[model samples]
Target chain A: MSVTSTTSQPNYHILSVLVQNRSGVLARVAGLFARRGYNIFSLAVAPTEDDALSRITIVVDVESTPLEQIVKQLFKLIEVVKISELDPRRSVERELLLATVRATCDDRGQVVELANIFEGKILAVGADAITVSLDGHPDKLDDFEELLRGYGIVELQRTGRVALPKLDREARLRAVKGKVV
Target chain B: MKMTGAQALIKALEMEGTEVMFGLPGGCILPAYDPLLDSSIRHILVRHEQGAGHMAEGYAHVTGRPGVAMVTSGPAATNMVTPLCDAYMDSIPMVCITGQVPTSAIGTDAFQECDTVGITRSVTKHNELVMSAQDLPLAIRQAFHIATTGRPGPTLIDIPKDVLQNSMEWHWPTDAEVIDSLPGYRPTMKGHPRMIKEAARLILESERPILYVGGGVLKARAAEALLELAELTNIHVVTTLMARGAFPDSHPLCLGMPGMHGTASAITAMQQSDLLVALGARFDDRITGKVSSFAQQAKIIHVDIDPAEQGKVRRPDVPIVGDCRLVIEEIVKAIRELLATGSTQADTSVWKSRISGWREQFPLSYEPSEPGEALKPQFCLEALRDSAPPDTILVSGVGQHQMWSSQYWRFDKPYTWVNSGGLGTMGFSVPAAIGAKVGRPEATVWAIDGDGCFQMTAQELVTASTERIPVKVAILNNSYLGMVRQWQEMFYEERYSEVYLSPDTPDFVKWAEAMGCVGIRVDSPEEVQPAIDRANSIDDRPVVVDFRVAASEKVFPMVPAGFGNDDLLLPPSQMARKEFLR
Candidate 1:
């Protein structure tokens, strides 16, 4: 809910929304934001563990619309069950980057080595191009993509950011130590 | 019992105690109309789909029940969009059942097909497309529940033709089951204890507190509780236009409607107050013209069932999301408990006197009747207001007549005065008056409409006559669209534009006679009362009284949209619009 916590361009909110799995629900949710003139930076919808529900991860720019207005408007949708904002400081966010980069037999090692450094997988290689898929934090992917630009970027795709709250310190410590409650 | 979806729809309506519904039949909805033949519920066939929707709204307003309307897809459903928006804006609980194209034919762009649910999504609180016959009962149950609960508004259920024709085993869902299915929808019905105490404390301690009541109070049926709370604090009450009759106008503490066209006293009282206890009212732009400067001295305590409305406009110092009646009842109890412990009430006597002084100095008045001049619209309204029974229900369409009706009428009861406040829907009165009369049969209902507004839905009088609903209509005829003319004269430098509607084009008298009702035309001030009395005396059919009034008179004291309430242009001063607009 607090977009001011993290200093970034175009103050944003990553809302993790749980919605009733019903026909046209996505349209309803998306239509509301469009109708209200709120900009949706990126949206990713997938079925949740519950077959009757779906989780929609929406990265929305809070530039013109108030964060509460977004939350309240979304809640007005009957299909929407809950909305919780994922704080950048307390959550983990990552995107998948699939790119086809220009690489010849002469400089294929440097391309492979750079991919190796980012723990990216080499999907396919041709006479003049190498395909790679990298999954990491959006910032990390940004840095990796910047380096790949030198190899002459051909085609690229980034799955919009998906996030979940990171386990608290106590829970993490307890899990590492295997402590009983 | 195995029954067709159409039969189940009827059975569900009966289960919800819907005695009557307004509708217009069409191809897709034909199957449902057949079931109505065997059902106990009476269907009032309307001339237009919009009339049916407004009738349902009017019915809901007086009866505290979800008014039901049925219509078919495509044009018929499209025709209902206005009423849906109107009901949505006013928070009227209504259920509109639309017959959609069959599920198999839905995406094919079949004949007479439109996405009813999709088109009406924003206007309705909730809407559903019943794809299966089995979901009909539950869809209806949920529709009523959603429409009547929380901050009530219109809800819709679009049933496909095939679905209605399909058969399913009937099973009525209990309230718990309905609640269980909708996991996300839970309205806060009561205020938190701590918040209630704090609100009571503020009410008791503030020296200049005013109760800014709104339509939500009437929606909640919280008028009694509101009256109790207001009396307990001895606070002055200013009902918003949406809340005209929510507080008794006869009460000494009541300051008429507050906002753009509100009374000078109400406007000033709100402007100067230290504490504003806004109950069931959003700080709508109309009420808060130039909102930043509106009631700058007041710390607002807002109570509403809708959370989104809490800080939508003016941020409340104490925001309590709950039913107005429950919240106000609790606040009253909390205040009493505090008072029992030796807490004293704030001294609002000086504030009260100042308000009284303003009320006296700038009382709602108009140009007096000249010997031969056209009858004043305000004079006609006062005649109707004064002659009507104390409990008679008054309805008005939006325009100069509507503003005059609000300004002049002495409404001392809740639900007795109904209008399209939020939507400002012209032509609402003609059909809404019919619905209100139907809902409250014994009470005399009147539609105070403008010449422009009356022309829009006057055809509904044929439906009223056929149904034998005796509602009276008063057309404050001013040749021109009076409100539009006034605005043009004041703001647009008197360029008359396309506002003038030739008065004699379709004679309202002949129009009423053709519709099988009594029509009376009054052109002078003296004829106002006699015409109203004559109209009231007739109980056989609807009565339309057209009072030709002067178009030059405009509503005042005017805040002139986008200006602060503090800058009211009380007439004679209205001629000095340049000074205020500057």
Candidate 2:
């Protein structure tokens, strides 16, 4: 089946969910996503940027309906208190952070120049190498990293994903209202 | 309240809730054996130590509990190595207890001192040489905890003679302390639903997706859940050697076993798929062939119970570690949601067409009429699978039959196919099946052995018959050592030496009957089924079906040694059909 997208590139998606912290629960959820062949962009889970619940923000490449189903399943877990898509259209701001370099002395200057243009900092420096770090939308960081790789690359590391919804209080009240209705 | 080390061990095992054990007594372990005599534990005195080891594996596989095997130190303990290696490779949970030379006499080259712990480290999940009475309880408790947790495997506790006699307070911990302390014991559950949904989207969007099922499905008892996901998504299923019959091989969507000697359809389909979802099975070298060309086109999603398995081989696009059953159930839920929202469907017609062509082109072939001259190994494996109970546990010794059994047996449940998959130890099945039969007396068990292998552990037959364990023994009695012979035939130009037994072979039938067991010899091809039926008829005595199969017969659908799946050799007859089908 065709993806039916007129765009030349593949579609990408991002989602946030609240889950109950329990043994074997993470395995179940991650296993589910994996079994279906979904490629995860980034996944971060920690005590909420807000409530007592655990907030799990995941970036994936897919359409809308599957994301909703995932949230519904998350809600079914007794420990999970809430889940949301964290719409990028209305959210404040989020970024993907990466550290990578072409570990060679000759191309080190070129790598540093690109990192500076991306509003990134050089995290490490060596006689034959340099490490640059950047935080931004995943697409932007990926583009910057790709540009660096043209030089003989040496190492790479990434903080897969993190997100905070902009509609903090209003979204909570609306979620409560939706639950009641 | 002070207790001896032997007493502490007994108390610890009792605390871990051991109800029964299989063992034999010997001089090195006289002190521990003395305590065992009076303990409430019901010890089945197997005729041989090796029998005790395999009986323990059998029991564990059936009961889903760790089976205990107790034996004296030195040679007795070493005798159990084959069985322990079998459980290690197949991931069965068991506790093998060996009594050693007294601690005071250790490292002095004392009589019956064989370094049981050192010898078994690689063959077990964890092993301990308990030196002090105080450490006895903790060590035994740890052995049980480690043996039954995660991807369960055998564990050993070697009790030195002096330590078994040393005094210490006997206190059974109400809670299993070692279980609480296990650092790597955490099992994963469901992943983020959002990720699962996206995976569902990937499944729906892909034109060619393959489902690579593994032993995790059987371990999690997730067969039904996996089948549901496969049917909904319309993806084909291929299993690893350890994961035979996770989905019924007879089903249309099933692609059969994939790897060296796997169905041509399955391997070709895997090579062509763009997205391969691997569940439970680790990508072993045998399964992956040449890593560079294996699943080169497929974006993989790996779901497994062990985290270390996730990126250890070929990296996965999505690495989800958890129980296979729960993971699959959640995937099905996500797919249902996608369908409601009008997501795309998988067009698997091209994949199926290509696989069907491969199947017809080189269908699993065994010479039907080659007579006593060409008794293919597959015929024997197929006969055993067809004749045994659907739920019968088929334990195999290492070599040609081990791989062939993996290729042929349609196993649908856990514990059904027990072989030393990674170790490839010969003389494993006979003892392992004995352990399995002891573990689950209700289930049928068969030790599918080769003549060369059965002789290694044949002493266990006396134990089986004495214990009233009616384990059927089907010997593929090809006079030559089959796998080694195949190498000689293909690579060494039939320069046969050492691979063949001397002209006069021992009478296996009379030997079994001598041990108070039933024995049947099949001299002709027509007697195969009847002998199997007769062997199945025995209730209290073990039966041996020694099929005098052709000595020159070789296992085919061959993947020449040290090569990947692409270089598989079809029998000259079948190679011609590849062009005809095209």
| iRMS per model in Å | 0.9, 14.5
Query: What level of docking quality does candidate 1 show?
Result: medium
DockQ each? 0.68, 0.02
Which parts of model 2 have CA positions greater than 4 angstroms off? A1-181, B1-3, B38-40, B174-176, B183-198, B370-377, B380-384, B412-414, B579-582
Per-residue accuracy of model 2 over A1-181 as CA lDDT, tens digit each: 1111211134545567666453434554565466445556667777754444566777666663355445543443324445567665545435555555555777777778888888899888987777777887655766776677677567666665567666567677997788522
TM-score of 2: 0.72
Task: Give residue A67's lDDT in candidate 1 (0 to 100).
Answer: 91
Error of 2 at B550 (Å): 1.5
lDDT of 2 at A80: 43
lDDT, candidate 2, B1-582, per-residue tens: 898887778777777889889898887667777777778887888767777877787677666788998899899999889778878777878998899998788889888889787677657766777778887877777778667766678999888888888899775553447654443244456655665766777788788899998877776778899889888887889987777757877777888888877777787778778888888888887788888778778888888767667776787887776778888888888889888888768777876787777777767666764565544566767777787876888888877777777777777665577766666777778877887777677888888888888888888888777778788888887787889998898889988768986323778889889988788987776777787777776777899878777777666666675676677667667776655332
- Model 1 lDDT tens row, B1-582: 999999999999999999999999888888899989998999999999999999999999988899999999999999999999999999999999999988889988999998888899888899999899999999999999999999899999999999999999999999999998998898889888888899999999999999999999998899999999988888999999889889999999899998998988888889889999999999998898998889999999999999999898988999998999999999999999999999999888888787877776677889887899999888888888888976899999999899899999999999998899888898999999999999999999999998899989999999999999999999988898889999999999999999999979789999999999999999987787789889989999999998999989989878889999777778784444323221
Model 1 chain B: ten consecutive residues of lowest lDDT? B573-582
